[model samples]
Target: MCFYDEMKGYHWDSVESEIMNRSRDDVEKALTSSSMNLDGLMSLVSPAAEPYLEEMAQRAHQVTQQRFGRVISLFAPLYLSNECTNSCVYCGFNMTNRIDRLTLTAEEALVEARAIRRLGFQHILLVSGEAPHLVTLPYLTSVVDLLRPLFPSISIEIYPMDTSSYEELIKHGVDGLIVYQESYNEDVYKQCHPRGRKSDFHWRLETPDRGGNAGFRRIGLGALLGLANWRVEAFFLALHAQYLLRHFWKSFITISFPRLRPAAGAFEPPCPVSDVQFVQLLAALRLLFPDAGLILSTRESPYLRDHLIPLGITSMSAGSRTEPGGYAHETHAEAQFAVADERPPEIVAEVIRSKGYEAVWKDWDAAFLH
Candidate 1:
């Protein structure tokens, strides 16, 4: 069964009750447990856990060090195109927007890839607006084949597709697949993606499952926080991650927390998660799933990102450009969203080193695929 099947039994209303009702005693009891369960996770995400920030962070840091060591895996996002058909209200690439659109040819993408490589990013995530007709499977295959020789890790944060398409991408050397649910609240999700194939919420929800079935070694999951109550979104997100872990045991499942950032649409996160609460949520996830990888992006501020590295963030992006063909071009197209941390790769790496941690640019070699 797809994750949707497993998820269908639960609803947001019920989950909201469990998390919101967690009391201070619940948080204390959950934190004291030697091994955390889903209830423990819910307690950690509770508002009651806010005052226990220091205790949570201390435990989260210890858990991370034990599981991942003092290493920060690094990567970059290379936006291939900003041409999208979806009318996602929170995005700059919404179809109704009046902006210049461009999809790079394979040659142009190579130039961008080489530029990214120069910045010491061996891992690259190719991003595009959901314009499948413009960014077809064959188009993506050629681009992946081109960069397969340059970068060791190539991930995609684009439109979702069937298992066959994911298998095809793997054949051409794409290993990492990152897809966000945007919001787990079904009603809000439908309203957020009013039109286009993205409007099919279950299909988007099952994307990582499809990717896992197609044998992707790394399958990334996340929620676009701010769409609904972060606690509600995070509970379902943790549930999804847990489901993937149980069913797809061989796959390395990753979780990312992409809070809403400003875009051309002037949209805002309805229930904005404060920085302290965001940190609390991260610590909760770390404590609950000690082995899972947590990825942070340039969507966060430099000060916050730096503060968060030691807390529980295992991987991060630096010197990221969210526009199509942004790396090589001086005049870039409109960005999907404005980036918060704009430090270059070297500087970010320097900052990581200053914390007495190693910033790793490359973690996977193709030989491991065997």
Candidate 2:
């Protein structure tokens, strides 16, 4: 069975209650546990774990060093389009928003790629809103084909597709796929995505499975914080990650932490996560999944991102633009979201060096697999 089927066994409220009921003793047991299971994760993310943040951070750091060493892989996001058909309430690219939309041609996308490459990014994430008609499979593959030689590693953060479609993208030199569930809570997910293909929660939930089946070397998953309770969201995300790790053993698994940010709709996060709680959740996830890659993005402020790097962040997006042709052309297209960390790639890399870790511009290449 897929994760959607496995997820049905546990109810949201029951999981939330279990986390809330965790006592300090439970937290202590989880901290010292050798095998970090979902129960250990629950106790670590629970409120009782608040008093032990320092301890957890220490353990998380040790685990991170053990698994990933003192290095952070840096990449840039090349926004191919801001056009979307989805009316996601939290997204700036919502179809209903009165914003300028643009989907780049292959040449325009290549221009953006050159700009990102000049910034010393050998790894690129191609981002676009879910505008299937405008950003079709052939269109995406063509752009990937044009960019195959420029970047050593290419990844996509776009719409979900069937397994066959994903396999075609893989053949076109795309090695990674990142899809966020936005909110794992079905009711919340439906409300956030009122109209669009994204409204089908189960399809989106099973996206990584398709990506994995299609042979993507890397599959990224995340739940947008602030849409639901952070602790409960963390629990469900960990559960999903565990499931993928078991079923898709060959594909490297990564998790992203994308907190809600201001965008076109001026939407506010209903269940905002505090900096402390965010730290707790990050530390908990690191302890639970030491080998998994935890990604931090430019959506968070530079100060926060800097302090968070040592806590378990393995990969980061530096010098990112969320609008189509943002790097190369002068366009009026609206960004999918405002970038919080505006530091240039070199500056971000220097900051990473200041923390005594190496900043890796590219960690994987297509040559390595062959």
Candidate 3:
């Protein structure tokens, strides 16, 4: 039986409704309360939380500064392939799309890794579409083996695999995994990912559990903002994060907020998230979980990225190229999306330094993994 079929009791619609019904007073109490829980998180994201954004932001800023200092960890995404079997409607790499498909060989991956290192990035996120036949466990293992010796830290933003597969990758030196739920609304998730392995919501939902079990160092969770009510979706993401933290206390956890950017063969978000609301959500999350790593991507404009530096964002991606072989072998292949902040890595590093924050390149050591 499928994972979802086995866990029929978990319904996303009911949770969404509960979040929608939260009152403003509830939001206030949650923001000011000495201890913030799931209920407090719901209030902070509900309509009732709008008036208290400033106060929440202040508390969040202080908390974030205390924990992470003024430095923002910087990283970049390296797209290895655009080949996918999944049919995610909101992604440019969906299988049905007629776009150039490319997968980096071991040498090609090393070439891209060198370019990333030259850009002063020690942290790298390897992204690919769900093409299990082409990008299987062994293939990923080889890629990790090749790149692990080059970059100290490597994370993957690829399809979900079994715990054993994850364990194998961990043994080969993979440190982190970022698997976004896209949206927790099951019906919406179904409508978006209509075909392939990604269609299984529960398998994806329980992926972090598997990752934690596999003894991976860190697991990242996120929602593609603009797909549904940002507040409701964010609440669920936070809940999932809390669950992972409680269950996997030894493993690190990070959260990302990726606003849906314009992409080929994808629908625009149903409810767009504005700049102010995005900042508010980030601040709210920082206040709720002071130690959690909050990451920003190149999807937002440079102005927004600059403004967000002081508002609780702890990590960022700079000079990102979303298409496969984009850094080393620029091709006309389809990118996951067009990156908004097109500044070169050096320029982005300069911006980060000007903001009085050191741009971190190397934070992890491969020797420690062994």
Candidate 4:
């Protein structure tokens, strides 16, 4: 059954009460438990656990080290296009935004890909705006055909597609999929995406299931932190992730925490997550899902990201450019979001090494797929 079916069985009242009314004792019990469950995770992520940040960090660090080791997977985002049809209120690519747009030709994409390869990132995440006509399956397949031979692992972070579309992508060499629900709260979700195909929340929610059925090796889920109450959004994200883990056991799951950043929309966040709470949330997620990958993107500031590395983050984006043709061309499209950590990939790798963690670029390969 899908998570929406489970949502029908749950009452938001109990969930809000469980999180908002959690006591220090509840937090303590969750942290001290020999093994974690949903109840423990709820308590740990609650505000009651704020005071025990150090303890949570220590436990989370231990759990992560036990499962994965002192290694950070490094990757870069290759923006394929910024020509969007969706009117997402929070995104820079909203159709109403007056900005220069770009849809990279296959040659331009290769130019950008070759530059990224020189930066030593063999794993490239191909990103695009949610314009069905502009970024169609055939278009994506051609892009994959152009870069699959150069990059060891290629992933997508574009509009969601059906199982058949994803299967076609897998056939052409797309190795992973990252589809953020944007917000799990249906009311808030509809409010944010008022126009275009993205208005269909249920279809977007089922994209990962479609990806799993298409046999993608890895699938990612996330909620934009500012869309709803961060705590509630995170709780539901954990629930969604756990469901996928149980059902799609073969796919490696990763969760990304993308906080609000400056975009073309220039919309202010209703509730911004503080550095302290961000750390606490990351640690709680790590403790609860020890084997799951926690990704910290360049959206966070350098100081905050530096402190967060060992806390629970397993993967990170370095030297990222959020605009189409951003890396290769000087006259590129406006960025969807400005990157906070401007450090080049080499500098980021050195930082990882200085912390005694190995920087991994290609631990995955297509050879095993056959």
Candidate 5:
């Protein structure tokens, strides 16, 4: 069954109550358990687990070291367009917003790709607002065809497509797919995305399954924190990840924790997650899925990003530009969101080295599988 159907078996209220009712003994049991499961994840993120933060961090660190070693894979986001059809209230690219829209041509995207290539990024993620007309498959495939020779690893974070569409892109050297559910709560999801194609919650929820069937090499999943109670959201996200991992055993699953940030509409996170809670959630995810990647992006501050490296983050996006044509051109286009860590790629790599971790530019090549 698809995750939406699997999700129906568990009631949200019941899960939240169980998490809140966890005791210190439950937290200890989770920490000492040989194999971590969904039940262990509950104890690790509970209020009772707050007092065991240090212990959780220590265990998360050791699991990460054993599973991934001391390396952090780094990539940069190459925004292709800011033309969105969605009216997501929390996003800067909401269709109702009066921001300038831009979509890069193949040549223009190559210019940005070359700029990112010079910055030493062998892995690239193509980003755009959810406007299918502007960011059509023909347009995306053309851009990927032009960029395939430059970067070995290319991923896309755009509108969801059918399995055939994802398969076609994979044939053109696009091997990874990243989709954020925004919020796992169906009610909050509907309220936040009031209009556009993104409003179809079940369609979006089943996207990774399509990508998996298309044989994507990597599948990334996350819920935008702060939309609902974080503990509830995290639980659903973990459930989603667990479902994907079991069905799509061939694809590597990565999880991202993107806390809501300030954008054009000035929407505030109704349920803000504090630093301690964020750490707890991250470490809890690490213990639950030790081999799955934990990605930290520039939405966070530099100081916090630096400190979060050892916790369980296996990948990061460095020197990211969140708007179209940001790298090669000097456009005054408004960004999707303000970058909290504006340091260049070199400086970010330097900091990773100081933390005794190797900053990897490229870890996979299509040639290896062939």
Candidate 6:
């Protein structure tokens, strides 16, 4: 049975409403209190919590420095294919998009991996559109088998799969999985993903559950910020993260805040999240979950990334190419969105060093997992 079937009776909308209705006092209590629990997290994301941004930032910085020190983990994305079966309206790789689709063979994948590694990226995020027939478990496993010897850590941001499939990948050296809910608003989600496998909201919602069950070392969660009310969706994401943390304490958790970028077939954001608001949300997340990993992608400008690095961001993707076969084979292919920070990975590392932070290329060793 699907994991969502078990959680079907539980209502997420009611909890989201409760969080949105939080008061100033609750926000203050959450900010000042030592042991800020799940309720505290709700208040931090509430609208009334705007006034405590500075305080939250201060605590976030301290907590971040204390836990992670003056270090920033760096990684880059490798888009293997653009052939998708899903029709997610907000993405350029959607099946409906009329663009060139490319899937890398094992040799092609190695060529791209070598190019990425040459730039000193030891952590790689393997990405592909949702096409199970083309990007099946065996295909992905083969890619992992080839890249595992090159990169120390590898994570996937692809279509959702069953627990057994995830287990198979994990055994083949997949370190982590990042599966965003896009938005927690069920109606909006359904509207955004009109057809194909992506329309099944409950299945997408339960992806992390499946990952946890498969014994993944880490699972990343987030809502695409601009798609819905950042506050409400973030609250649900935090709740989901909290639930996973409580139930699967062994699995490390990370959160990414990817504001929507202009894609091939664009859709206007219902709720546009500003830079300041995004910072506030990041600070609040840090204050709430001090030990959790916060990631910023190349979608933000270099200036914004520099400012955010010290605040709470622990990991970042630099010089990302979102298009399929974007690195080695084709650079002018269709991209999911235009990357803001177009600087190369080495330049990004220089910026990190300028800020008195070490850019970590490899933190995890393959033997450690064994």
Every model's Cα RMSD, please?
0.9, 0.8, 2.2, 1.1, 0.9, 1.8
How do the residues 252-366 of candidate 5 rate in per-residue lDDT, one tens digit apiece? 9999999889999899999999999999999999999999999999999999999999999999999999989899898867788889999999999999999999999999896
True-structure RMSD for candidate 2: 0.8
lDDT for each residue of candidate 6 in 138-202, tens digit (9 for 90 to 100): 99999999999999999999999999999999999998999999988788899999999999999
Worst 10 residues of 3 by lDDT: 1-10
Instruction: Rate residue 107 of model 6 by lDDT.
Output: 81
Candidate 6 is scored at a TM of: 0.95
**Against the unseen true structure, what C-alpha lDDT does each candidate score?**
0.91, 0.93, 0.85, 0.88, 0.93, 0.87
Candidate 1, TM-score vs. the true structure? 0.98
lDDT of each residue in 94-208, candidate 2, tens digit only: 9999999899999999999999999999999999899899999999999999999988899999999999999999998899999999998999999999999999999999999
Instruction: Identify the superior model by TM-score, candidate 1 or candidate 6.
Output: 1
For model 5, the superposed segments whose C-alpha errors exceed 4 Å read 368-370
Instruction: Write the number of the candidate with greater lDDT, choosing between 3 and 4.
Output: 4
Clashes of each: 0, 0, 1, 0, 0, 0
Cα shift from native, residue 290, model 1 (Å): 0.7
What lDDT score goes with residue 258 in model 1?
93
Model 3 lDDT at residue 138:
82
Model 2, residue 137: distance off in Å is 0.6
Better of 3 and 4 by TM-score: 4
Cα lDDT for residue 121, candidate 4: 93
For candidate 5, the C-alpha RMSD (Å) to the true structure equals 0.9
Better lDDT candidate (3, 6) = 6
Show where candidate 2 strays beyond 4 Å.
none
TM per model? 0.98, 0.99, 0.95, 0.98, 0.99, 0.95
Which residue pairs in candidate 5 collide?
Answer: none
Question: Candidate 3 overall Cα lDDT vs. reference?
Answer: 0.85
